[model samples]
Target: MAKYKTLIFILEGSLLNEKVAEQNALRQTLKLTGREYGPTERIQYKSLQEKTKLLGFDERIKLTLQEFFKNDWISAKGAFDNQLQKQDQLNKDVLPFLDEVKNKVNLILLTKEKKDVASYRMQNTELINYFSAVYFKDDFACKFPNKKVLTTILQQQNLTPATCLVIGTNLVDEIQGAENANLDSLWLAPKKVKMPISPRPTLHLNKLSDLLFYLELS
Candidate 1:
């Protein structure tokens, strides 16, 4: 029998190369503001990124522009919005991995993105077909790391915490969210990112394809 009755997947970073998209958008934003991306900016951006995890997407962009361009931040924010809307691509291994596990367990896509954005991205990438259900921030009326989001999902799906696994790339959002909900979690750790010592995920893997082996589907 399958170990998990349901697998909750985070849309960004887990299935999509959202970090690449964000980096591309950041570079485009910098270019629009007549600045270049250098080591200093990279370091600063990473620091800011970590600090702004709880903020909404627009707020993060606004803060990023303000940090880089004090006088021209407003215009840069608009540019960043346009740049971000054009970004979003699935990780190369996503389709094959999803195919392998689609029948083994229920696949649920959960994202903090609003319905319009999430639907557009999934439609563009043809990812909606793989998921049995997709839940967005709009549906929950709250962003993740809130235990209620997971609990609600569990209640709606008639699942127990022990029988479901939350898979995500972000520690604060996915892993912590799962922990808060008292559910098992699998972290698809981002490259060069350090794993936290406390509140760690139940399992950690380097890539989406690695899940096949961990899940005994290989």
Candidate 2:
């Protein structure tokens, strides 16, 4: 008998396309605001969206209305969250890898999103079926960087500490969480910046495709 080889891939960050969309939006906001307002923050966009909703300017005039009211962090965060929710589905490029490695990999979405919201988004993206298990924030009553949360998941699934991997964008959270759980960790650093401090990952990957290579060579 062989021990179960569980290769879990954790997904984070809103769709890459949405990030581009955000940049375009920020440029538009600068033009509308008549002055570039620092870096575009999600919280600001979300708050603006919320204010737009409360004002009831109608969708047709929302942009003009936003220009008049000025942008704020809360409004931006609200807008960003709303848009992000729609785009927060599974990544397309990752599908090919998941399909190729289905036999060996057990993809799990360990996210901070609540179960209902995360499930709906995953289902909409048509990516829910690929995962062996789904872990949500409510399931643990705690977020990443919490060792007890990962430990509980492993304990429930009877997983060996050494056979698991936690992958995510935020270095401190995902890498630290995996380390605290006593599991192998993969840090996806797209920006290619050196980690600020200690608690480094078992592996550093610049792209999702790199994960396949790392697993193959490791």
Candidate 3:
């Protein structure tokens, strides 16, 4: 039998691929603002975005564009929309694993993306069918690495720490959040992804298909 009754999957980088930058948002911002910005300015803009993450991804991006680029709602909104559709590629290997374990495990989507964006991507990829429930970033006031979000989910599901597991691509905050919640976690780190020295999760897997072993699916 599988060890956990509930499996919570982080949606952004965990299932879908990373965002591919087609048009430079930075340049777009500068052009829209009619300002000259060099590498240093670009670096500063990105740093600010990372720092103000508590405001949420889309919100932060929108604010950054408004503050730096000024009065270009159309361009700023376009840049945001581009990112929503960027990582549409699926980890094909996960399909078969989901097929085998779908009936046995309670699937849940715990994502950092906004609800509308998450729904759009999952629906486009036809991945929404796998999850019984989805909790988005907007759903929680406190973000990941804070135990409150996971604690709330656990309470809602009436599930204990021992019976739940989080499978995510991030080794830093994701794993730390799971541990903080006292729940087991599985880190999905591909060879191409450079991981920092961080707290390890219950399992470190290179491929999503590796979950089949834990599922005991043949």
TM-score winner: 1
Best by lDDT: 1
Which 10 consecutive positions of candidate 3 have the poorest summed lDDT? 18-27
Residue 156, model 3: Cα distance from true site in angstroms: 0.1
What lDDT score is found at residue 210 in candidate 2? 60
lDDT of each: 0.80, 0.59, 0.72
TM-scores for all candidates: the values are 0.83, 0.68, 0.69
Off by over 4 Å in 1: 36-63, 71-75, 190-192, 216-218
lDDT of 3 by residue, 183-203 (tens): 889888765544444566888
Q: For residues 1-218, write the lDDT of model 2, one tens digit per residue.
A: 12325755554542223334344445454455465645454456566654442121123135533443455644554554444444443445667766766656566667656777566556646456667887877888677677887899888888877767776655556677778888877766554466545577777776666666545422
lDDT of 3 at 47: 76
Q: Cα deviation of 127 in candidate 3 (Å)?
A: 1.6
Give RMSD to native, each candidate.
Answer: 3.3, 9.1, 5.8
**Residue 177 in model 1: shift from native, Å?**
0.8
Worst 10 residues of 2 by lDDT: 52-61
What does candidate 1's lDDT look like per residue over 19-64, in tens digits?
7888788898888767889999999989988887545455766787
Model 1 clash pairs are: none
